[model samples]
Target: MEPMDKDRRVPDRYEPGEGCLTTAVRLPVRIVVLVLVVPVRLVWDALAALGRAAHRTVLRPLGGGLAWLWRTLVVLPVAWTWRTLVVAPLGWLWRTLVVAPLGWLWRTLAVAPAVWLWRYVLTPVGRGIAWLVRGLGVALVWLGKALFVWPWVALWRYVLAPVGRGIGAVVAWLVRYLVVVPARWLYAHVLTPLGRGIAWLVRGLGTVLATLVRWIVVVPLVALWRHVLVPSGRVLAVVVTVVVREVGAAFGHCWRVAGIISRAVGRFLGTVLRWLFVEPVRWVYRTVLTPLGHGIRDGIWRPVRQALRTARETVRQTRRELRRALFGAPREPQPAAAVPPRREPGAPGTRTLGSSTTALTKD
Candidate 1:
């Protein structure tokens, strides 16, 4: 290996050293944070667990049951009633009274006539009316041209146009001398300067007003906002940020602590339950109940079942003897092959005109 240089060295597992301020700050902060967080965390976790348990055990089932009951008892019945009593009757009445009559009337009167009129009567009549109206419109246009448009056109072109031209020339000349020249001169010489002075005064007044408004209203407001309100808001924001950060940190720590506590508690509870209830129950099942069940089975159940079987056999024998004594000994059943009377009757042939099925002919 190269000689280790003072400036260039291989780094190992690096552990950063903490300052005294950090070391002093961390322990008390952690202690204070733990103190603040623990109770809140425990309470929050407990309430949350309780809420979850309640929802699972009580609220969810209750809500489901209520929903089921509502659906079954109220919604189903109401829907059935509405469908059966109201909807069905309304549908029947609508079809029977409203739909049938209106459909028939519409089809018979309105639709049939409308169809006939549209197809046969109205089509030809409307075409004829359109043709007549078109011809009349042409004639009316000719008459209108003669009566109105031609007269106006002639008046404008022949008489009124020349008079209007002469009047326009005179008016233009008079207006140029009387109105236009004087107005242009007044605007250029008098009004322009006066407008410029008025505008300058208005601009100066506007500038003064702007300065006053800036000093009296805007500047102070700006200053107050910048110097006073801004600083205040910043301070409030810092305070709020610090409070929120601490609260957030506390909440996180509390949650972890609470979780640990909750786990410990749960373990303790589990242990207690195991030792107190589960172990005892298990022991009873193993030592007491199992032995008792076996004893009941071996000592009582088996012997009782065997005795019942013997009693049943004795009763069956007694019944058989009583039956034999009462009815005398039962004759043994004869074989069907040995007894011809016990054999089935043969199948009969179909009766015909030549065959007789009477008892007299039967063999």
Candidate 2:
């Protein structure tokens, strides 16, 4: 790895081969890609800037206002309605009607009956049935052993087993002499060396074919890839890199210029809008409407409001008098005693250079 790294340390990145053909191709390809990529990069940068401006100036505030309006108009109201009309009523109904009745019914009908049946009836019946089943299982097992299992066991152990063993020995002897011995002889004496000879011939032919293919096809292709295509690719890559760098630089310059022009235009538009609409509205609001609204609020609206308030107070006083006359004066409210607020169990003061921070040592 260290040797390979040393060898590759000063490797050429692009333009590895400097030749006439590469030079010719590089010039034209750079010129074309630059021309094409310049306009594309400029347009892309402009559009991207415009998109950012629109998102920042127009879409962002609009989206925030829409979200706020949706929350206020739709989401909050729907949530309140669901909580008030659906969830509250459902919760109340589940508690008052479903839970109470279902709980009572379960306790009265299901629980008591199931418990009684399991304890008083099912337990005794199950035990009796289990005891009977266990006795029958034992008896059946012994009877089956005497009638079926013993006969089969005796027949196999005493009679059929010996016969089967003797027959198996005879068959083994016949198979060894008749089939296995001849097949082994044929494989060892005849087939093995023949297979070896065939394999050797195949290997020799394979070697020749492999050599021919390597020299005819693989070597040429490898040489073409390594010597011709790689150098050409490197030259093309260098041209592409240069073109891209130029285009990127051009895009940076163009984007800066576009932003400057955009800001200038925006300022011009802002000035025009201020003169045409904003100034008149601001002047009118300050000069005319402010005084008029203040006059209306003070002169007429306040007087009417004051009159209504006086009437309300008078009515309230009369009603209070009538209540006092009927119910004999109400008892006065007593004042509450002030109590100190709770103190949490922690150090009250902050620690400084001279103080210890532990709760037990507060100094």
Candidate 3:
């Protein structure tokens, strides 16, 4: 080999072990640090990547399934339980409180219309009926007056006064038919007997009364002497006047017996009447009056209140109708008549006054 080529070649003494000291040191430190930490860092990064991917892969489907299952099982049951336990009862309570009152108010509102109809319509009809009745009464009175009194007045003026003179012209016929001779016969025959009968009845009654009084006075005194005084005197005068005293005692006993019998009969009749009628009346009073009085009062009061309401409505309707008739737009008032103009005295001799008003009419 040439000398230059041999110089380009590595020298035998410049060996690999104879490198730069800084390069040698730096290369060993870098290699050792890489050897110690590079593989462990690579393993840890790979494990973290795998863990993140596994977490995503597992949690995605698990979260979706769990959400669906919760909606189907847990959430639905809880919602149903709430509806059954809390919401449904609350809704029922609200309906009972709110809807029931609303229904009652609606019914009350409906009843108000019926009441109004009765007041405005039926009340007016009743008032009209009353007015018609009053008019009929007045008409009847006028008709009665016209038929009875007017006819009598007309007959008296047009027929009876003139016909009464004709009756006087038939004096002889009247006398023969129903005048002096009949009067005298009636007075003689009927009046005489009637008077005599009345006088005889009166005289007879007076005589009977006087005889009764005399007998009543005399009989008591005679009986007193015959019975009491004679019996006592005879009884005292003798030891025991048996016949006279027994007769007097028998008369007195008869009177006492009659009185006692009459009293007993009257008392017995009174007792029977009390048992038959009075006890039943008292029982009925207690049962009906005391216990059921309020019910009876309400029963009667309802109809009477309705009747009073109807009567008040009728009166109000009558007044309203009268007001309408007097002041309603359908009826117009009549115009006043024009007064005649005053003329001056002795002002003009032949001046003619025109009519005070022309003919006026409503369309």
True-vs-predicted CA distance for residue 180, candidate 2, Å: 2.9
Q: Per-residue lDDT for 128-205 in model 1, tens only?
A: 999999999999999999999989999899999999999999999999999999999999999999999999999999
Candidates in order, TM-scores: namely 0.50, 0.53, 0.21
| Residue ranges of candidate 2 with Cα displaced over 4 Å | 1-110, 271-363
How would you encode candidate 2's per-residue C-alpha lDDT over 1-363 as one tens digit per residue? 012232234422344766555455555655555555555644664577679889999999999999999999999999999999999999999999999999999999999999999999999999999999999999999999999999999999999999999999999999999999999999999999999999999999999999999999999999999999999999889778766755554444444444444455557767998999999999999999999999999999999999999999999999999999999899999999997564453345744444456556865
Q: After superposition, how far is residue 241 of candidate 3 from its true place, in Å?
A: 7.5
Question: What tens-digit string does per-residue lDDT give for candidate 3 at 154-273?
Answer: 989999998898888788677787878888999999999999999999999999998998799988999999989998887666533433443444444333343344445546766897
Please estimate how well model 2 matches the true structure, expressed as its whole-model Cα lDDT: 0.80
Query: Which stretch of 10 consecutive residues in model 2 shows the poorest summed lDDT?
Result: 1-10
lDDT of each: 0.79, 0.80, 0.71
Model 1: clashing residue pairs? none
Please identify which of the two predictions, 1 or 3, would achieve the higher lDDT against the true structure: 1
